[model samples]
Target: MSPRNTRPTTPRSGTRQSPRVALTPRAAELVRRLRAEHGPLMFHQSGGCCDGSSPMCYPYGEFRTGASDVLLAELGVDGVAEPVGFWMSADQFERWCHTHLTVDVVPGRGSGFSLEAPEGVRFLVRSRLLTDDETRRLGPGGPSHGDASADTSAHSRSGGPGRA
Candidate 1:
């Protein structure tokens, strides 16, 4: 009998896997363009209402985040030198922390506050719960950074909010 072949898919020693958030090819192209026109960029995931759970992109420092917000992951897009910050409401993150996020672009109108709205496309988030291995690799930190006093609410929530 022939011996069975086996190999592990895990990263080799000293190698590190990227965060849970990723950008689709089209999303990456749009992010590059937005970064060129707008400078630094950040993404916040909406829980519901307004944009309906879509990930909104804004120029860095435009939308303020607070302790009620959580930094899910930092996405490194192809050709973009700076990693994009991905945040969520602390309440929302509680529900989504175990899922992997993939930013994607689709045709149609999005929130005007998002940098991509005027480009005839909208940024969306495709998500799925993380696998056991991913959960282990990520370890256990839900929230990354947020100031205690800043308002976590944004335009995607009820009554609409500010852009910059």
Candidate 2:
């Protein structure tokens, strides 16, 4: 089967918590390729600035993240040595915390500064309303809310979106 047709692993039901973010199969494949060329990678969702709301890919640490950003998830892609951190602006997170986000890729030029722009594809976010269980798990404040350094160990090893 084509890799893109394969489904990402969903979280097992019951007590296991859901992940706040995930990557589509196509996105994972792109990440694997990018990692080979760039060494390591990280993603930050733009908060309607120069890049609008698209997810921006950068070489690890290329983008500065601080108190203004929220570390939403660490996506583990097959064949990649390290998980890719997914971050969002604290202000945007406040508006989006109630939803589950997925990273996907499409053919087009993105922000010139983002690593993916050179590859003729850009990363985008796909989101859905968090289920009751997921909302409760993340709580009203959402995972890691205002603190980028908050522990995200639970999401660090997850292969993809945590769906029952």
- Assess every candidate by TM-score: 0.77, 0.75
How many angstroms is residue 116 displaced in model 1 relative to the true structure, after the best TM-score fit? 0.4
Q: Per-residue CA lDDT of candidate 1, range 1-164, in tens?
A: 00011111223221111446777777878988998898768788888998899999988667788767776655555556555667788888778877877788999999998999999999998889988877777765554656554333232233323333
Q: Which pairs of residues collide in candidate 1?
A: 155-161
Residue by residue across 30-134, what tens digits does model 2's lDDT show? 888898998678788898968779988887766666667777776677678666777788789889977888788999999998887888899988889978876
Best by TM-score: 1
| Superposition error at 90 for model 1 (Å) | 0.8
Show pairs that collide, candidate 2. none
- Which RMSD does model 2 reach against the true structure? 8.9
Error of 1 at 131 (Å): 0.9
- Clash count of each predicted structure: 1, 0
**Model 2's TM-score against the true structure:** 0.75
Candidate 2 residue spans exceeding 4 A from truth: 1-18, 145-164
